[model samples]
Target: MCRLTFFVVVLIPIIFGFCPPGNYEYQTNCYFFQNNPTGFSTAELNCVSIGGHLASIHDGFTNSLLTQQSLSFFNASTDFWIGLDNLQTMGNNWYWTDGGTFDFFDWSNGMPENLQTQNCVAISMIDGRWSNENCFLSKPYVCAINSAATTPPPSAYPCSGGFLYYEPTNSCYGVYTHQEDQTWSNSESYCESLKGHLTSVHNYAEFRLIAAFASYGKYAPWCGLFSNDGGRTWQWSDKSSADYLPWQPGYPSGSGPCVALAHSGLINADCNQEQPMICKIQL
Candidate 1:
């Protein structure tokens, strides 16, 4: 008889704080625990606004991690609002407000007194112990978002130009990064076919928006703005007045025949370098 043996190795990824700015990572979750004191309802609302919910700990490791973080930041073991609650079903098994599975509980001694008035849950920053509390009490909180979450683009709005609409200017704008990178001139030409020009940044809002896109996509986008005659003058390809210039600080490094939206701001990029682009059309 032949004997065969196989050995398997499991690797638990060591990715601490692999979350977005102002967040910490544990296992597969990103936590944004902070010192913003608010009522349980208000805290949940705040978390929801940022694409997450009050933190939910399903395992002892996570509970300990959250407790340690709270201690490190707030310097005390005070109470911090968590996602567990029984507001909807008093005197029954609690539920996570974020809808996570309630498979674990770390109640402090004499917890869940099952008082009629106490319908919310909180975790002790001191040692990760949980306790029941009145839902109206204000407390600091932890919000947990999916580590795999993404910065989703705006929902596609119906417009005649087949792109997102800018109600402020009665124009349509489009960002095209999915296509193969192309020279700035070619980008502008493609926009021309759609009866548009490289998009212009008329205000700070558009500037920040393009900057966000560049940061997330890891690619600068060609715009209509360009400089000629040694950076002394710049103009938009569509003949619009260059009313706004959100250039990267200490940039224009040199006179650029072309410009692209960079993470920081507009930067002079070699026109021939293939890049993505944003276009706009007055519909």
Candidate 2:
């Protein structure tokens, strides 16, 4: 009786669909379950159209909640699409479509087979266990909607040549693309020549300043963030904290050991792709 009461109390809002009509409120985000069968890519696109991504679970509670909701929502006895996939071309690993951490999962035994053809993930409607499925298969999906970020102001401080000062992190940033487009290696070398390394982002406010560099208008430039084994871990070229990762929906899903900043967010790109770069020096 005690456990049931606690569970029911915790589920009040989620069970009542307290969000805008047809949406379920859970924590700070809203989830919308779509019963229509759709392919994984199509399902993700549908979610993104509403300023969110296909639901990405971070903990067991969320997993259980989705499972219970599936029983209440989806009529099919099969599976539903979630935002987990091993689409990164560089390695056979799974990542969240909303760019959340890849820490928790409840994969069924022998599941996530990692077959190249079965890269997308779906949750069982009956047990909520995860399984890697062919991306083309149609499945019901849930969308997790949330808020957005605000742009940051720009300023410069006297530290290094061609660097701008971002007060929050007490660091200087430089956008280098003048002489020629450079690969990630070349960009880091250029930054080293300026007594710094490729930029390392600490948070979203700093990221916004880097993305909307004045006049450049939403520049896509190489940053220090890189994952050696694809989507598992990230490190800065400057060896700074790499905590703030703002990725475009379903991003970090390509062949990547390199990262770049864009209006959408951090993206995985081929290291050899010549582009402008951002450099940072801790101050």
Candidate 3:
């Protein structure tokens, strides 16, 4: 008779206070739990309940590995959950769990065509491609709890008189608000009085913050942009458009007289419609 015996001991170091409650980063000691197969929204709630959030991949390398891991966990046949979801409206709108806009766009080639209502975002193993999937479907997910702060965000935009919050990334400015609602012209005047126009968010991060502080009662905001110059002639109040923007569908419509920034960051709506507006300040 022959017999073989083996022993293994695994030690998991309990790092005390590595990340604050409900905080996460990339490439750090982040906690991941695979249980109770959940959809995108449920998954986010789950992560949040555990003092964390759905993972966010900032770069290509991590994005690739994450997609692969999710596919493997789900038997390489089905999709799993991730932090990305376009459940905002229906068009090309996406947001991350960490209160940031979807700036790191890596959509599969010829994808996001909005071929169907599958607007929710998901990752795939077939060459780390990202595709829109049903938010109700359940799949394994690769989320980060605490990784690392990749780049030091740019300082908030400079506001002189009233107040200003600068976004270090895009050099964009946001207005400090104490109210839940403001009018388009009123917000515009508020920003103008301070020598700054309403906030003109050029990217997603600022959009996230703006949405949180401004968006109330399903209303968009009248950002520092307008089609008055012409249908395509949209410009920021700062008289700068160096960073060309890609507007979403059914936007800048002639019928929609007033324009307000949508919570999704890419879309804008009419003014009277009631959306969040930025209260700019002088810089």
Each candidate's clash count: 1, 0, 26
> Model 2, 178: alpha-carbon shift in Å?
38
Best candidate (score: lDDT): 1
Error of 2 at 189 (Å): 36
Total clashes in model 1, counting residue pairs 3 or more apart in sequence or in different chains: 1
lDDT of each: 0.71, 0.69, 0.53
User: Per TM-score, what order, best first?
Assistant: 1, 3, 2
List runs of model 2 lying over 4 Å from the truth: 1-18, 147-283
lDDT per residue as tens, model 1, 1-283: 2221111111112233358666688777788876878777667655654556689878998888888888766654388998877654454768786677899999889988966778789988767788999877878889887787654444322244335454456566666764467788988998898898988888754553344345334577888988777778889999988998877766777746799986556888788987778878876
Q: After superposition, how far is residue 21 of candidate 3 from its true place, in Å?
A: 8.1
Give the lDDT ranking, best first: 1, 2, 3
lDDT of 3 by residue, 1-283 (tens): 2121111111122244454454333357464634456566556644543434577767887777665555435564555566776645455456677675566867778877653467556666566767878766776665555443232223322323323233343332443333345556666776676566776655554454454333332345567776664455666766666274535455656644345655444454555553455644434
TM-score of 2: 0.47
lDDT at 249, model 1: 61
Looking at model 1, report the run of 10 residues with the lowest lDDT sum: 3-12
Which segments of model 3 are wrong by more than 4 Å?
1-26, 29-54, 57-81, 86-118, 121-167, 170-182, 193-196, 204-216, 230-232, 256-258, 264-275, 280-283
Candidate 1, which segments miss by more than 4 Å at Cα?
Answer: 1-18, 156-283
Better of 1 and 3 by lDDT: 1
